[model samples]
Target: MKALVKTEPGPGHVELVDIPEPACRPDIGVKIEVKYTGICGTDLHVLHDTFKNYPPVTLGHEFSGVVVEVGSEVRRVKSGDRVAVNPSTAVVCGTCEYCLQGYYMFCPIRRGMGHGVNGAFTKYVAVREDQVYKLPDHVTLEEAALAEPLACAVQAIEELTDLHAGDVVLLSGPGPIGMLCLQLLAAKGCRVIVAGTSQDRLRLDMALRLGASLAVDVTAEDLQQIVLRETGGIGVDAAVECAGAGPSVLACLNAVKRLGRHIQVGIIGKEVTLPFDTILYKQLQVVGTLAHSQKTWVRVIKLLNQQKLPLTDTITHKLPLSRWQEAFDLCERKQGLKVFLSYDE
Candidate 1:
């Protein structure tokens, strides 16, 4: 099977190569034929060697596929059923204190799929059946590929924060994740504000159409004051930092109201210098999240089924699996919102 292997960690180290096809074993896991895979910012960070990551890795986590073969115990999913996977993997003793409290992300046995194991960047991947969720018939395979990221976004917005209706939200960055944040906030009846540079005009426009009350170029003159004035001399009720840039982190801090909530969703390549004094003075709550929990993936599927969150609007590019490099390049160059590599018929 063909796969993009990251033999080295640095810019452009990801290579297209052929590898063994995934096999199903009764006591092991189910085999899935990957239909579409989405490249994420973490994949880019691994490529740039900005963070600690395993080498010789298959570098895709956001993906969806169809069941090709099932393990003996994998009655949850069967062959021919389309599905999406949540990439966060954790093993619990079930007797552990944390597992008893249902806080498994902190489990010592926690291991991410793409980081700790071979991920979904190949023609086929074998994963635990418990990690898979059946796709809605209305959701195309390409859109199903968004479930992983969507689960993360949903967890960040719904579970990780104490948001309320009529609160003002400043979403920094017009990337796919940021755009998804905008829509999710809007859905909750928040007055969503989107911020990005002038180059993100198209994305900003899309944000407004998706329910953002205001989308502004943060680089514009007097933008900070404009935000302050719009919020009636107070900053926004919450801010989501999705830009993953040092300056953007500071911007999110400066945009939040006193004691406001800030969800850090983006991956910063280096140590970010932040205004701790400002955060302290305002009594701000800053939180960071990794991948989503199993519960969150279920919520994402429900949202997709009810048409509450339309991920398709943010999907701007799709290429064949053979052109994985091209799809990855577009994401690295920031030329498109979301790019998918399709492998199935």
Candidate 2:
């Protein structure tokens, strides 16, 4: 098998090299033939040594695949079943309080699939039987490849917050995760305003197409004015920050109405100075969210089953495994939205 491995600790140590194929063992649970894997912001971070990652490990986690073989202990899914994986399931302490509650992301001993252990950047991957969620016939492998990110959005919006239909939402960053959350909020009948810089022109346009009530380019337009006008001077009911930039975080804090929600979905890698008084004065329900839970995955699959969202609208690029660097560049340059990679099979 060919895996895209991070050979060493550096800005550019990734290589597409041959490695031993993961065998289907009773302890490993299941073996899957990866069909499509989506490039995520975390993958880019790992590439640049910005995110915590182990060396000599495969570097993808957002993927969908078919079960090629199942260990003797595996009974949840058959060999021919189409499935999506739970990234956090690869390594976790099952006895922890967080894991006991199905929130593996909070487990102290948790080491996720992509950065923590070997991931699915190649033709095959081995996963625990419980981590494999059987995909419905209605969902294509490409669409399910985005399930990991969609699950993260589900955790932020559906599980953590108190947002409801008819409420107003201000979402910053028109990137892939932001776009996914926009559609989810839209489906809940929330009128959303998407904010971005001039570089996000294409993404901002797609945000409107995905159901944002307004898309404001922060560089040229005033987001505060737009939020006030859109809400009739009341401000948005909730402000979600997805850009992870300091400006976007402050904008969400400033635009959200007093006592409203401000959900942090983006992973801000470095520390930045923030207005500490904003939370105190506004009395806002500020929430910090991480990865998805089992419940979150359930909601994601349910949402996909209904087929109400136009998820594919955000998929702007697709390339083969050999062109993974091109896909990475497109994402880093913000040239497109979701980029899917397929193996040579």
Candidate 3:
């Protein structure tokens, strides 16, 4: 099988190499013939050596596949089942406090797919039964590849805060995750203002098409003034920072209503200066969210099954696995959204 492997520790050591097909563990795992895999921001971090990753391993997490073989104990799925996988928190100590509480991502020894172990950027991948969710017939394999990221947005919206209808939301960043957040918030009846820089013109336009009340180019316009005008001189009821940029975080802090909430979904690799006084005076609640949970995945799947999310609009490009570099370049250059690497027919 051909797999995109990060062969060693460094800035650029990734390669497409032939490797042995993974065997399904009869007790708990299933072997999947990968269909499509999405190139994510974390994958870029891995390529740049910014995120923690296991070398000599495959480098994709957001993927969908068909079950070619399943272990005897894997009753949840069987051969020919089409599925989307939750790459993180797949393997964990079931007895740990976090795992016992259904917060397996917090388990002290959790081993995630892609980073901690071999992932789905290949012809075949062996995954634990618990990590796989069978896809509905209505959802295409390309859409299933989006479920993992959608689940992350679900976690941020459904788990991180108590949002109500008609609430104003300022979403920073018009990337794939941010666009998903906009759709979810809109479905919940919240009026969303999507913010991005001039470089994100296409994405900003897509956000408006996906129900964002307004799309602001922060570089070209005053975000604070727009927030004030949009909210009748007050501020947004809640703000979500999804750009992973320092300026975006600051804008969220400044534009949110006093005592409102700020949800951090984007992974900012380094430390940044924040306005401590603003947070203290405003009594704003700031929270950080990581990957999705089982509960989140359930909601995400439901949304996809119901055809409620506008996922197709966000998928701007799709290339074969052999053109992995081209896919990565499209994402890094911000020329496209939700780029997919097709592995099989």
Candidate 4:
């Protein structure tokens, strides 16, 4: 089997290598033949060594595939079943309090796919059966590949953040995660102001098309002015930061009303200088979130099955696994949106 492996530590250490096919452990493993694996921002972090990822591991977590084989103990799925995976449960201390609460990402010894263990950037991946989620009848494999990020969005917006219908929101960065978060906010009936830099012209436009009330090019136009205009000088009810940039963070802090919710969904790999006093003076309800929960995945799957969001437009680039570098380049350049790597011959 050919897999995209991060062979060693440091930047640019990844390569396409021929490795032995994975075997399903009889008790709890499920071997899947991957169809479409979407490139996530975290994968870029791993490739740059800014994020923690064990070397000699495959590098993908957002994927949809067909079950080729299932372990003896697996009862949820069987051969030929189409499914998506919840990578956060790849390796966890099942007895921990967090796992028991369905928040597997916080399990003391949790190791997610793509970072801790081998992921789905190849022909076949054998994950714990518990991580496999059967795709709904109406969900295409391409759409299912995005369930991971959508689940993360659900966790950030619906679960972790406090937002109400008709509230004005400031959504920073129009990346894949940010865009998905936009959809969730739209569904909640929130009036969204999507912000991005000049480079994000394409993404910002897509955000408006996806139901955002306004799309501000922060680099050219003033974001704070627009926020005040939309919210009648009261600032937005909530601000979701997904750009991972220091300026975007400051913008969110500045645009959100005093005592409003400020949710951080982007992973800023390094610490950057910010106005720490703002959070204190504003008395804001600030929350930082990461990784999806079991319940959130369930909600995302339901949303997809119900055909509530038109997610196909977000998928702008598709390349075969052999063209992994090109796919990475596309993401790095912020060319379009979600980039999918396929396993087609």
Instruction: Sort the candidates on TM-score, descending order.
Output: 2, 4, 3, 1
lDDT of 3 by residue, 1-345 (tens): 789999999898998998899888989898999988888898888899999887987999999989999888889898999998888875688998878877778989887878779988888999888888898898988889999889889899888899989999999999999988888899899999999999898888889999998999988999999999999999999999999999899999999999999999998899999878998999999989987776888888888799977788888998988899988998987899889887743
Reference-based TM-score of each model: 0.92, 0.98, 0.97, 0.97
> Candidate 4, residues 1-345: lDDT per residue as tens digits?
889999999997999999899988888889999999999988999999988889989999999999999877899999999998888788888898888989888898988889899998999998888788898777899899998998989899988877889999999999999999999899889999999998899898899999999999988998899888878889999999999989889989998898988999988778899998998998999999986888898788788889788777789999999999999999998996999998647
Instruction: Write the number of the candidate with greater lDDT, choosing between 1 and 3.
Output: 3
Considering summed lDDT, which 10 consecutive residues are worst modelled in model 1?
90-99
1-345, model 2: which lDDT tens digit per residue?
A: 788999888887998999999878775488999998889999999999999998988999999999999987776899899998888778899999988999888888788887899998899998889889998898988888888889988888888998899999999998989999998999999999999999999999989889999899999999899888888898899998999999899999999998888999998899989997898898989899997888898888887788888988889998999999888999988998999888976
Clashing pairs in 1: 10-47
Among all windows of 10 consecutive residues in model 4, the one with the lowest summed lDDT is 129-138
Candidate 2 regions off by >4 Å? none
Looking at candidate 2, the ten consecutive residues that score lowest on lDDT are: 22-31
How badly does each model clash, as a count of residue pairs?
Answer: 1, 0, 0, 0
**Candidate closer to the true structure by TM-score (higher is better), 2 or 3:** 2
Residue 199: error of model 4 in Å?
Answer: 1.1
RMSD of 2: 1.1
Q: Which runs in model 1 stand beyond 4 Å of their true positions? A: 9-11, 90-104
